[model samples]
Target: MIQKLLDSGLHWEKKEFGRYGFLKTSGSTDTDIYFVEKGSVRIFMMDENEERIIRFGYSGNIIVSLDSFLSGKPSELYIQAIKKTIVRTATKKDFYEFIRSSEENLKFWNSILEDLVLQQMEREKDLLISSPKERFDRVLKRSPKLFQEVPNKYIANYLRMSPETLSRLKKS
Candidate 1:
């Protein structure tokens, strides 16, 4: 679905970011959708003082701060580059206009939205599991490639566990 959008010849601004570079910052109304071309990006927010991991975008993935995009308001979310990354971006208006231009594009957008909702539900289920092992296993089953693309420290944060615990689980 995302590939279809990328292949649609829509005007996209190709941008590059160094490690820790921010794509979106907290307290900003940034509704741009990004398509990752290389490397990776992390979507997070500060919880008190701690940075809470929310989601990640790898090569070939489309990412946006959805809440901001949908609500047209500033969000607490922050999007950052995990490494040297290249992404193509389109404004919310352009994206919607493109989708509206054709029934097929609309279906593609719907599928993408559906997948996002389902992924959120799966994350909720993972959070409901009290056991760390269960959460680890569930995520591994769902997105095994995450382990390869993201650093263990960030993965541990996303799983709400310590780095040592994640290491232990990996070793087992």
Candidate 2:
């Protein structure tokens, strides 16, 4: 279904970024959505003295600053390549036109939103109820690629644990 949409006149620009390249920067109003073809992206925000990682997007995933993209506001988040990466991107205008073009497109858009919401809910629940070790274990079980592909500091921030804690967990 996604491939169908991508095939249906939605212009996709393929580009490569070096590791740590900024795909979207904080306070930018760019609303381009990216489909990861290879490698990973980390969505994050700088909070005072710390970098808080909101999420990691890998191959076959869509990466977007949803609030900013939808509202046409400056995004508070930054989207950065975690490694050498390939992505296909479509601008906000093109994305909306495609979404409004057909019932199928609208349905697909809704499904994407639903999945995002569900994932956020699960993440929030885990943060509230699970131990740090449990969260780390869950992430490892679900996306072991993150451990190998993303740096330890980023992973520690994403898991809401200290780097020392993560190192200890890795040893155990």
Candidate 3:
């Protein structure tokens, strides 16, 4: 999508986020999506004081508040920088226009949506798995790069386990 936009003669500014900086805060209606040029970010919501991570975007990934983008409403999720990051942004309008501008781009967007659906289904299945070890193993088998790119503590939260449990699982 980033490349497609660039190929379309669209120019964008690259923004920097220091570690722990917020790109979008909860309750803001920001319809912008960012391509992670470097580093990583996480999309999460607070659940009674607990931060539940919904997703992570690593280098070369696109990050956005989907609800806000789709509904044009205040977002309940936070897009936070996990490390110092650089991102190029596109608004929802530009994104839609770019994707609809070409048949190939439309197919590309469709493919991305399909992958997101599949990933969400897998995440639901993972949450339903009762055993921490099983959840850990399933995720590891599916996205081993997650373990490499994301911190164990955040991964543990995503897996609904303690960081200690994740460490033990890695050791085993």
Cα lDDT listed for each candidate: 0.92, 0.89, 0.87
Give the candidate number with the greatest TM-score: 1
lDDT for each residue of candidate 1 in 1-172, tens digit (9 for 90 to 100): 6666777978799999999999999999987999999999989999899999978889999888999999999999999999999999999999989989999999888888898999999888878888999999999998999999999999999999999999999999
Candidate 3 wrongly placed segments (more than 4 Å) = 1-6
User: Candidate 3 — worst ten consecutive residues by lDDT sum?
Assistant: 2-11
Candidate 3: lDDT over CA atoms? Answer: 0.87
- TM-score-better candidate, 1 vs 2: 1
Model 2 TM: 0.91
CA error at residue 123 for candidate 1, angstroms: 0.7
Q: Write the per-residue lDDT of candidate 3 for residues 1-172, one digit (tens) a residue.
A: 5566556754456899999999999999988878888888989999999999988898878767878888999988999998899998888887888778789888987887788788889999999999999999999999887887889989999999999999999999
Compared with the true structure, what per-residue lDDT tens digits does model 2 show for residues 1-172?
Answer: 7678678899999999999999989999868988998999999999997888988998888878988988999988999998999999999899999999999899999999998898788678668855888998888987788788788988998999899999999999
